[model samples]
Target: MTRASYVRRTSEIEHYFDRTALAAWKRLTGDQPVSGIRATVRQGREAMRQTLAGWLPRDLTGWRILDAGCGSGVLSLELMARGADVVGIDLSAQMVSFARQRAAELQTQRSVPTAGRVDFRSGDMLDPRLGRFDAVVAMDVLIHYAPEDARSVLEQFAERTRRGLLFTLAPSSHLLRAMLMIGKVFPRSDRAPAIYPTDPEQLAGQLVAQQHMSGWRVGRSQRISVGFYTSQAVEVVRS
Candidate 1:
């Protein structure tokens, strides 16, 4: 897509969520943080759960968790439900507002601590002031950055996470590229996602040597469908 088209697409997405954020919380589940009302909520929730399973420890009772690019606070809300202390950040102000409202609503109705455990903030993915956490998560977020910037973002992720890190990205492969090109040409869907694609081999090389997080692994999560593959990766800090 052309630069102007990309900008327009991003703006359109932001505005869409800005209008629809609160409408999402009327139906709340433990999975609703990542499971906002889209044309496809079920698929989104499953994809988020699969991606988050990597950095989520079975016993994260008091562990501080960070949800980067926390859209509508779906995954952050889910983490709270599961007993982790969560801090979720998203680029969209409307999303942050919706997430906070959802938490309040859930807390009021459920009378549960799950709602109290989460904190949501508004910030850019590229901001430097974001703090550290025991585990950091960025589902379907990093792939938005250019491939050359992906390594830096990974390094920042490692730096911000004290124990572990998790994220998802679109695969850079000939087949996927061809598909993206064809999709853009025909306009099969207006909800075309911007992907910063990177080859798995290149990611492995960057993770192993450049960032020095050598034990990372990348694997596909439960596929919501054919086009949107949720992939998970984890890198344990050596310290």
Candidate 2:
């Protein structure tokens, strides 16, 4: 994607999550009651999270992971439980703050010892200053970006990633395309950012063709669908 387009889209996402839908997102990620559609989304997201986590080593002691675009820090807490020192970064400062608060509450309520630590930050997930990691889990983060931009984002992560990378995308399909078109007809105030669907095969081919990603190859993949939520997980690992 062009630099200008990326910047504009990023700003839109920040605004949506930080101001437009903050309360709704909190309820969706929390145990609070939500509408039937959102409930299905919540279930789908949990399943996707588990799918991504299952790709990593069971015992993550001494492993450093990045929860890129970690909304509400659920995945970060899960990684910490597995003994991975995690850094959860999100574009929305409000989301990051909520994540911090949620993490603390869970820690207090559970009274469990976590072998790893989590540092939640509000910033761009592609920021290099966050440092390298053994694995990077970017659940549902790339689904909004155009395919090319999504691939470019992954290339940046590959530069800093040591062993593996896990992320999700909205797979291309006629039904999903129709859904996107239908969503656009909704009132502006009632809409979320537009989701861009991608073909997994094409994306994998692009990754393999990139010279910078020569050492990395696409690995396992899975798709999860529940009500209004559908996402595909793809893994890239060192050769």
lDDT of 2 by residue, 6-82 (tens): 88888989989999999999999999988889999999999999999999998999999999999899999989988
TM-score of the candidate numbered 1? 0.70
- For residues 5-112, what per-residue lDDT tens digits would candidate 1 score against the true structure? 445545654554555443553343235344324425455555556556644666678778888878767677777877888888876786788779877887889845
lDDT of 1: 0.62
> Once superposed on the true structure, which residue ranges of model 1 sit more than 4 Å away at CA?
1-41, 173-175, 182-193, 211-239
| Cα error, candidate 1, residue 94 (Å) | 0.7
Model 2 scores worst on lDDT over the 10 consecutive residues at 106-115
Q: lDDT of each prediction vs. the true structure?
A: 0.62, 0.90
All candidates: TM-score: 0.70, 0.95
